[model samples]
Target: MIVRTIRADDYPGLNRLHASVGWPQRSPDGWRWLADNPARREIGAPEGWVLVDAADRPCAMLGNLIQRFVLDGRSLYGATGFSIIVPPQHKGASRPLIQAFLDQPGVFAHYTLNANARSASLYGRLGLRPWPEQTHALKLSWTIDPLACLHGRLLRRAYGRVSAEAAETMGERLMNRRLWRPGPLRLPHGVVDIRDVSDSSPYGRFWGTLSEQGALIADRGAEMMRWRLADPDLPRRPLLLGRVEDGRLTGTALAMTAKTSIIDPPSLEIIDLQGLPGFDAIPLLARTLIRNARGLGAAKVRLQALTPDLLSRLGDLARSARREGGWGHGHAAFSDEAVAASWSPTPLDGDYLMCNRPVPPAAERQWARRRAQASRASKA
Candidate 1:
């Protein structure tokens, strides 16, 4: 078998490999997005590396996303592995694919989120040290009935209709709970207004301002926002909220409905949150997300606070919104000690924000049409 960087033409084979492992198949738009992404070229490789047999059939693939940041007064690089697939026949391909990723230069660190025990052991042997601090800081919103949630999970595993109804009911109850609801939209005396904005709005400005005041954060400027938020295959459009005072954007937050394997009901994930020095806008932002999530029928709101300061502030905000602290983990590995020490990663840093959901028949047809149009355009 030969291991090599994946190219656009390899997506069909990759999709087949993904299916063989029971992973969600990528939409045609997803494959196109991967092909067109500039980061692929920036990393001097495609979205991943694939191992192919003598007949040129792909047997394994490791996918990643490269994110650049300024850490400790210098430019730093990181890549997060999003997917690794190897079938029983291709078991031998895993090591070589991982080794090729490790050999890539210029990346100061490699990160993975929510790795299973077996994968963790393999990564540990390959020099990836787990950063537990990042893993321990997740905050959860809304109260859930554990038994109901469990029933939903079991039903879903068996592909039962009751699962959908149960999940929806659980979501509605979680949102309708008085504890999860903030009485009204109330801003402090200085805060002039709170409202929704487009993801491509001036929120990037607020992100930049906060980056200057806080620790090193992944680049989430206009370009990154467009690339990440505008994916057509995304199950839900990100909700963007902003706080303004005297016509200046003081704070911003972005949330999306996401499905997780471990969680029975879908969740509203807070992927990005930025506020001015006092963190005055966080509580309001949290309230708005909870309210909107209720409309989206999401069971909970999830937040990741990477730094101690953000963690404390978010914890307080969650408490104000009557949210509970739950056990969730985020993991990272670094090549440079200093960069790793200063680095702060949010759920938005990598492909973690992209959650797979079952597509409705109508949506699937729409995607099929779009795929045909894209193929025609490409051939032209």
Candidate 2:
């Protein structure tokens, strides 16, 4: 039973393990990005960890170390997409393998991962606790339909003008905004390209940078957003993307509707919202989203507070009610990881105040059941 750092060459085997466990396939480019990501090397968990049985077969693996967290002005590390993919015969190997995985130096520092309640318990054993928080998906209620709201022709023209140079610059600017201080961005009306439209655009790039840089971290990103947009299994959840103007994508939103209960009005989740320098557009972006929600017959929209800005600005939108705070314990060789730290969490007193909403107990229980099921299934 050996637990060790996976090398770059192990990617294919890791990919195979993830696929065999009902996970999606990964492209070479994406996998390479994960392998070479700066955060992993800085924290000393570069390849995350792969557990091999005595014979040295790669029985299980966790994909990437996706987040860097800043708590009280210091940074912490968290793993996103961490998994153990032991074959059915080796299912029972997970417990010890996970224990060994965590024993790896720097493995637990500021690491945050979202699991069902049961997994949370496993984390507890490892000194990782649930950050008392509830994530909400907000669907804005808009007075207009999505089709009517589009200035499509204008956007197409705008996307056309976006050169790779512009893309790179906007991308870099957004990266700066997330990692450094926030300020107004001055942009000529024509230079931005909001076309890729989802978080993969400047905004998604910001969140990814945030996680990778140690500001804020999450368990998922671009791939999940891309997948959600095309997810066929979840029939109730329809996908939509919007840009403030053609190239300047100010916001991105996603919604999931339930099939069991029409009376169980569809719920919309604002997966990620990124506002450009002119912050005024953020409110408008919020409003447009709500209008879209109303069109879909959603009961109420849910939104997660990625940073303090959303909580502060939308804190008073008439329908904007406070949701519960999500909390977690993260640790990292803060000093060692600082060099690679690209971002930090917004000050607690800043516009980053997160509100907590009630998480239905039943929902929590259901989620726990599902997580336990996933854990058990993985073991099987």
Per-residue lDDT over 231-333 for candidate 1, one digit per residue giving the tens place of the 0 to 100 score: 7776546666677766667777777665453224656677777677764676667666765554555556666434555565566554554333343334556
Query: In terms of lDDT, which candidate is strongest?
Result: 1
Best by TM-score: 1
lDDT of 1 at 320: 56
Show model 1 residue runs off by greater than 4 Å.
Answer: 71-75, 132-141, 144-148, 156-201, 261-263, 304-307, 317-329, 355-380
Worst 10-residue stretch by lDDT in candidate 1? 172-181
Model 2, position 349: C-alpha lDDT score: 12
Tens-place lDDT digits, model 2, residues 142-171: 222233223322444555434434533322
Candidate 1's clash total is 1
In candidate 2, where is summed lDDT lowest over 10 consecutive residues? 349-358
lDDT of model 2 at position 15? 72
